[model samples]
Target: MRQNAERCTAALSAAVSNYVDIFEHVEGQIIHAHQKDQERKRNCVMMPSKKLQTFLSLPKKQMKKSLSETSELEKELGNYTCALHARLSPNEHTAIKNSDYVKLSESIGTSVKQAKKIATTVKLIRNVQKQVKKPEINPSKEFTMAALF
Candidate 1:
């Protein structure tokens, strides 16, 4: 499990850092192009896109919000993991530590008893869904005297 977690953590870290680096590189190129175009066109050029401007001019609150959102997204993405120990990226680890899962579970009324009931109920529902009727060994073809009365 530890090995799996380490492997997964390394992979996620590499992927996320790679993605962010690529985006920053692209953003830098856009800014550079805008600057060169402005100098070349001399007041006849389109301004940098709103996205670029927003990326460049993120306020403190927005920066914090974006970081929190990224962490949350990464945490949720953890659920899609099918292999190995739960390798958590740094952000996801932080998010999980910060989240009050116990409180949330309590608020949602998800106790051990409720969970047990739900599990049994789900099993029963699946049995009903199978729709397999058992064959009757003895056929009661004749009408009973009680029915004749």
Candidate 2:
């Protein structure tokens, strides 16, 4: 009878230890996930700036093509005041409103009305580029890290 009691006590202890190990593993995973989430949030702060820079730096032909593609959709939807237009400065608004179609068309390498739209889009992109702060990097710190590696 005493041996049976000891066997049962040992089994219970083993089960308790197993449960503790599982709990600790799960806790560690949760902490790791939280840390990853925080790092993602930090990185996302500069995502808009990166996107804006990429768009602005595109080749002129590619930029014009992108603007033309969106212009068709804008006309179909009959939505003239887009998010980009909404953010335009007063001067940009006036420029688009009173733009010389022939001059703009020749300069932008597009049709008359499409040239106006492209000009507006370019202005909006430049405005956003100005507004979005670029991430600063310390060259000395980067050099130190590279040296460590």
Most lDDT-accurate candidate: 2
Q: CA shift at 57, candidate 2, in angstroms? A: 12
Which segments of model 1 are wrong by more than 4 Å?
Answer: 1-3, 43-149
Clashing pairs in 2: none
Q: Give a tens-digit lDDT track for model 1, residues 20-126.
A: 99999999999997776455434221222454235325554454455456764323222322110122223322333445444433433466455344333333322
Q: How many pairs of residues in model 1 come into backbone collision?
A: 0
**TM-scores of the candidates in the order shown:** 0.26, 0.33
RMSD per candidate (Å) reads: 26.7, 20.0
| Collision pairs in model 1 | none
User: Model 2, range 33-134, lDDT digits (tens) per residue?
Assistant: 778655543431111244344545677555555545676532422233344344334444455656655665653346887766566555655543343334
